[model samples]
Target: MVLKRIFTAIGVAAAAFALSLSAASPAAAVPVDAPTPVKSRIEAAAAPDTAAEPRTCRARFAENVNHRLRAEAGSAILGSIPAGTWVQASCTRVAGGEYSACGLSSDFWMEVYWKGNWGHGAWGCVQDWEYTS
Candidate 1:
């Protein structure tokens, strides 16, 4: 009986001590010399340029032809695009390089007819219009 009473007393004292500590400890207490918060140096980059600016795309010079006068249907030719063949492409992502689809307008992808061939130029070699612009 005495041992039981001693154990009960110990448990009660422990509980009381815990309660006292919890009650006394202030979570928001500031230290005497709190360091000032550093202001962030970085700011958000300028909002994505939303205003559509008028731009001109040009055709490749005669000296730098993009495709041969009669490029084979199934070959990937590169050089410069011919003049007077400028077409507006639907702008997609314009980062370091432009990402676009061959569109008739802002949202009109065109399907070119290549004799017996069908595919897109994933390389997206920009035409002369893209270069001058």
Candidate 2:
């Protein structure tokens, strides 16, 4: 009976020690409401700046082009713009889908705002080269 009690006491002490260690973890050392300067800086750097703003202009496609929901070429096609169609686009050319045309090769996806709505069919991205003067 004495041996069993000693073993039980050892186990209880070990468990208590483990609990104390966990409570002293680095994360636990910081106050729950402490300001995280490093995390805030990382978030600020990741946010898009005002320079990414789109420029409104008219773009005439040299050929039929697929407009995708995202800048990627493999993204879902929102609609198709026929050849020689002049579209008033609020375009922000960004690195996206790759394309080689109009005697040029690039990975810029040009934004296209179809009609008025900025979302849904007719609103998406097309190859940068598809936009002509």
Q: Candidate 1: TM-score?
A: 0.21
lDDT per residue, candidate 2, 17-80, as tens digits? Answer: 9998778768767888865233111112222356454435555565576766776656787677
| Backbone clashes under 3 angstroms, per model | 5, 0
Stretches of model 1 off by over 4 angstroms after superposition: 25-133
- Shift of residue 120 alpha carbon in model 2, Å: 12
The Cα error of candidate 2 at residue 17, in Å, is: 51
Scored by Cα lDDT, where does model 2 land?
Answer: 0.52
Clashing pairs in 2: none
Assess every candidate by TM-score: 0.21, 0.43
Cα lDDT tens digits for candidate 1, 1-133: 9999999999999999999877744644645786533211111112237636753333222222234222232335433333344433323312121223232112111122222333222122333324223
lDDT value, candidate 1, whole model: 0.34
